[model samples]
Target: MEESDTTKYVIHAHISAEGVVERPDVVGAVFGQTEGLLGADLDLRELQKTGRIGRIEVNITSKYGKSSGNILIPSSLDKVETSILAAALETIDRVGPCISKISVTKIEDVRSSKRQQIIERAKHILTAMFDETVPESQELTEAVKSAVRVEEVTFIDNLPAGPDVLDSDAIIVVEGRADVLNLLRAGIKNAIAVEGTNVPQLVAELSKKKTVTVFTDSDRGGDLILKELLQVADVDYIARPPEGKSVEDLTQKEIIKALRSKVPVEQVVEVPQRRRNKQQMQQQEAARAEQNGKHEAQQREYQREYQRPERPERERGETPRRKSLRRMEERQERREPPKEQEQQPEARKPEPREAGEFAEIMKDLAGTLSAKLLDANKNVLQKVAVRDLANVLKETNGEVKSVVFDGVITQRMLDIAAEKNLEYLVGVKMGSIVKQPANVKVITTE
Candidate 1:
C-alpha cells in the first residue's frame, strides 16, 4: 500500500501477490464492502480491477517478518470493526510466519449517502415543529398592547339640586366615586369626580366641553392631587373646604352652606379682609343710646324739681310732712348729678346718620351680583330674561357683564343707549332687531 496524506484513512498491506492491485479497484472494493456491512451504497469496483494502477503499492517482504501495529479506522465504522479486527490481529501475530497466511487490517470505515440524508430530514422536521407553536400568543399580545388607547375623564353616577348648591355653568370635579355619590345625594346633579389624580382622557374631553372647577379635599394628599391636576388640567376654579374637611364628611346643609359661601380660588390666595361685624357694632351703639336716653330723662326730672317753688305747709295734726320733704329735696338739689348722668344726651342718640350713605350700604349687600352673573347655574343663567337682569342687579352686590332679555328691544332703544357704548345684547327668547350699531353683539339663546 502507498502512504499518502491526502486520503482520509490509510491501509498498509504486505501482499504476497506478483504485482500491485489497482488503487482505484481497491478503493471501489472497500466502498462495496462497506456498503454491504453498513447497509449503505458504496462503489468500490474502480480500485480492484486496474491491475497496473500506481495509486497503491504491493511490497513483498522476503524476510517473512510478522507485522503488528495499531490502525485507525474511518469514523463511520470505527466502533463496528474494532473488536473483531483487534482479536484477529492478536491471533494472527502468535502464529508462525513461514506458512502463508491471509491477514486483514481496516484503516477507514467510510459511510454512504443514504444514512446521512435520513438524519438531516429528522432535524428539519423538529425545527419546523418548534417554529409553528412558540410565538403565536406573543404576536397577539404585542398587537393588543399597540392597538388600544386609554384616556382620562372625570366620571360620576349622580348629583343634587338647590340655589345654595354650587351650580355647573362650569363643570365641577371631585375626588372619588363615593364623593360623587354623596354630592348626588345632596341634590347637586352637575358634578363629576376625578376618581383619582390620574385624569382620564374622557374626563379631559368633557372638561373642554364645559368650564371646569376642581373641588378637592383640604388635606395634604388632596393638595398634592390638586397640584398634579392643575399642572395639566384646564380648570376655571378651585373649591376647598376648611383644612382637614372632606366632601364625604359634610352634611347636606354643610354642603349647601359651603357652596353658597365659596370664595374664588384667586381670592383664596389673597390676604383675608372680611368686614367687621356690622350687627354687633350696631347692637353696641343701640345699647349706648338707650342708656344715654334714661340718663337724660332723669336730668330733666331733677331740673323740674329744682325750679319748683317751696310751699309753706298749713299746720294740722301731722305738722305737714310735705314741707319737710320739700326742704329735704332743696338740700339734695344742691348736690351735683353723677358726671355720666350730667353729660347724657337730651334724647335717644339720634339714629346713626342714615342719609347720603347709599354707597356704603350697597357695599354690605349679602351676595355679589356680578359674581352671581358669572357663577350662576348655566341652565338657570341661560333662562334669565333681559328685563329680569335689572332685578338681579338690584338683588346682587356683584357686577353684571351683560344683560340677557326674553323679548326684543327696538332700534329706538339702541339709539337711546348708543352713547353708552354697550357691546352686546343677549336674549333667551326672541328680540327685536337693533340696526345701525354695527359694533354691538346681539345673541338670542332660544
Candidate 2:
C-alpha cells in the first residue's frame, strides 16, 4: 500500500452477497474481474505495481447465510481515471461461489480536505501572533481616547456639529464637516459647520442665544462665506486660518493660535466698507478723466471745422443765371486778376451710407432680442438669437464685418469680437467694460 501522503483520491464501495463471502474472496474478485476491464493504463495490477493505486481492503460480516461488507481503494490518478476504476469494481458478480453486488458510494479528493484544515489552522496562528504584538497600555489608552473624541461628533439641523453645541455658552461656526471634526479633535466641543457658503437658519438662531465665533478658511471662498454670515447671523468674533490655508488642514496648535487672535465682528465688517469707499474714490477720479477726454475731443473737432478756408464770392458775370453774367464776371476777373480764386472750401463730405444702413438695421432689432452679422458690403450674413451671438461669431472666421445685437454688450462679447477683428458693435446697453479697443467702434442705443 502507498502512504496517504502520495494518495490523492479515496474510493469507498459497499459489497453484498446472497450467501457467505470472506474478505479474501472479495478482494481477489475485485482484482481479477476488474483486470483488463479498462485499458492497460488503468489495469488494477499494473496501477498497483507502479504505485498509482494503493492496497485494496475488504471487511465483512456474516449472518444466517447472508454477507455484507465494504471495500476501500486509494488512487494517485486524476478524478476521471479514479472514477473509471471505481466503476469497474461493480462488475464483480461472484465472490468465491456466492452471488455478490458492489457499488461505489463516494470518491473523495484528499488534498481539498487537507487544504481546508491548513487554512483554519493558519488563521488561528496569525491571530495569536498579532495579539502579542499589539500596542502597550498608554498607547492603547490614547488610541481609545482619540476614537471617543471623534465619536462625540453629532448633527444639528442637518449640519455636522459637536455633542455639546446646544449647551455650550459659546459656539464655533466653521466651513464644512471636516473643519468641525478637526475642531472636535482639538477638544472644542461647541463647533458646527455651515456646510457651504449658504448660512443655515439653525446657525442664525443659535447666534442669537450663544456667543458665535465665525472660523473660516483663508481663501476667497471663506471671505465670501464670512460676508454672507455677517449679513444674516449675529456673529461676535471672526477667526481666520493662516493665509492660503484651510481650517480642516490646520493643526491643533495652529487652530488655538488663530482662535486666540480672533478679531471682533465689527472690525472685520468695517474692512469691506473701507475697501468699497476706496473703490468709489477711484471710480470718481476715472469719471473725471473720461469727461476731460471727451471735452478735449469735442474741442479738437470744432477747431478743425472752423479753421477750413471759405469759398470766394463769384463776380456778376460768373453767375450761372445768364451767359451775359458769365462774360461780365470774366471781364472783372481779367481787370483785377483776383488773387488766386480763393479755393472754395470743399462741401462738407456727406456721412457714409454704410453708417445709415447700420442704424436702420439696429432700429429694426430694437426689441427683438436678436442679432445680425453683416459683411463688408453691408449685406446681412446671418441673423441669430442674441444668446447664441457669441458662438456664431466665433464660427464666422472673420467673415462677419459688423455685429448689431439687441442686448447688453458685455466684456466677453467684446473679447470675441476683437479676436474676429470685427469693425463695429452696436447694442442696446453696455456692460462694465474695463478696457476698450480703439479699432472696433462700440455704440449703444441709449
Candidate 3:
C-alpha cells in the first residue's frame, strides 16, 4: 500500500483496570511511557491538535466492567507506531490489575487529498467518537444546517457572543447551534456547543485542554451528550439547572447563577443518592435524642458537685468611682479610728450605678482610646486589648479602625494590651486597679 493509501495504521488497545478503572495517574503514566512510541507530542495542545495519533485507540476497561474509555493515536508516523505498540504490550504486563488488548483498525487512506478534506475528515472522527448516538438522517441533516448557519466571533466560529468572552474561570460544553444561541441569549459565552455528538475535533481537544465545566440539559439527549464528553473529555466541573431545564430554557440571570454554582467534578461523578423524607426525618430525630442525652448527663454531673462561696468585695479593686469614694472613707475612718466604730467605710458605701450607665461610660472611654476595633457585642470588643491596639494596627499594616467599648473593661484587659503593645483602652466602666500598669492608654468614660 502506498504510504498515503495505507489503511492499517490504526492500532486499538484495550486496557482493563483492577478496580473501577485505571487511576488517572496510571493512565497518565502509561501515556507518558508510550509517548515516544505513539509519535504524539502528548502535551495537551498536541493531543488536542492531532485528535488521534493513527487508527490506534487505547481502550480502558474497569475490573467490574462498570466503566471504560478510549484514547486514540494516529498511525501514519512509523516510528511512533512501533513505539506505541511496544509500550502498550509492556504496560499490559506491568500495570496493576490491568490487561491490555491490542489490535488494529483499517481506515481508507485519503492522503494526498486537499488540506480541507483532511481537516473535514479529522473533524468528523472527533465528533463521531464523542457522540453517544449518531443521529438518523433527519436529525443529522438538521444539525448540519444549524451549524452552517452559525455566526463567527473572535477566537470562536459560528457561535454567538453572549457570554462574556473574557471570563476564563469556567467553561461550558453543550450540543448544537441552537443550544449555542440559547446560551448566548442567556449571556453565557464561556460555552461551546458540540454541534452534535460529533463535537468538533477542536472542541474535543479544548475539553481535554481547558479547565472545563460541562452544563448540558436534563434529558436523555443531553445525557448522551454528557456521556460522550465524560468519555473523551477532561472536565473539572458539572452544572445543571432544575430538571426539564435546558441551557436554552434558562434566562440570563439563571444562567449566571447556575454557572456560579457549578458542582465539582467528583460530585458530578459520584452524585449523592437521595434519601426519602421520612428517612431523613428519622435520622434528624436520632441525632437530637443523642444530644439531649448528653446534655442531661452534663446536668447530673453539675448537680453532684458542691459550689464554693464567693469572696467578699474589696474597695481598692472596686469600680473607679467606688475606689475614690472608698479611699476618702478610709482616710476619715483612719483619722477617727475607734471613735468611729459604727462607721465601717465599706458598709457606708455609695449606691451602685445601673449596668446601662456603666456600659455607656466604657463606650465613651473606648472612643477616646482610638484603638482598632474587633467584634463588639453589647459594646464589648472580643480578643482586643488597649496596649496591643497600636501593635495590632501596625501588624495589620495599618488596617485597624477605631475601637469602642460598651462593657466592663477589667485590669486583665490593660495587662494584655500592655503585653501586646496595643494602644488605646476604652471601657464601658472602670474598675479600681490592683495597679495601673504604666504607659497604657486606659480610658473609662461615658
Candidate number achieving the greatest TM-score relative to the actual structure: 2
Q: Which portions of model 2 miss their true places by more than 4 Å?
A: 1-149, 271-446
lDDT of each: 0.44, 0.77, 0.51
Q: Residue by residue across 369-409, what tens digits does model 3's lDDT show?
A: 22336321333343443333434534543222224444334
Lowest-scoring 10 consecutive residues by lDDT in candidate 2? 341-350
lDDT by residue (1-446, candidate 1, tens digit) is 44233223333333231223333333333333333442222212222233211243333333334322222222221222333332333222212222223245544422333357778987897667556566676787578977652222232323222222234566667777656666766766666766677766655665545666677776655767666665555555566654335777577887776666554433222111221233346778998999999789767766665556654434343233455556557867997875552331111121234222222322332122221133222222323322233334455433333333333344443443243444444432222232446544444332
Error of 1 at 427 (Å): 42
Candidate 3 Cα outliers beyond 4 Å, as residue runs: 1-169, 270-446
| All candidates in order of lDDT, best leading | 2, 3, 1
The C-alpha stretches of model 1 lying farther than 4 A from their native spots are 1-169, 268-446
The candidate with the higher lDDT, 2 or 3, is 2
Deviation in Å, model 1, residue 139 alpha carbon = 59
TM-score of each: 0.24, 0.31, 0.26
Q: By TM-score, how accurate is candidate 1?
A: 0.24
Candidate 3 backbone overlaps, count: 29
Question: What's the C-alpha lDDT at position 238 in model 1?
Answer: 63
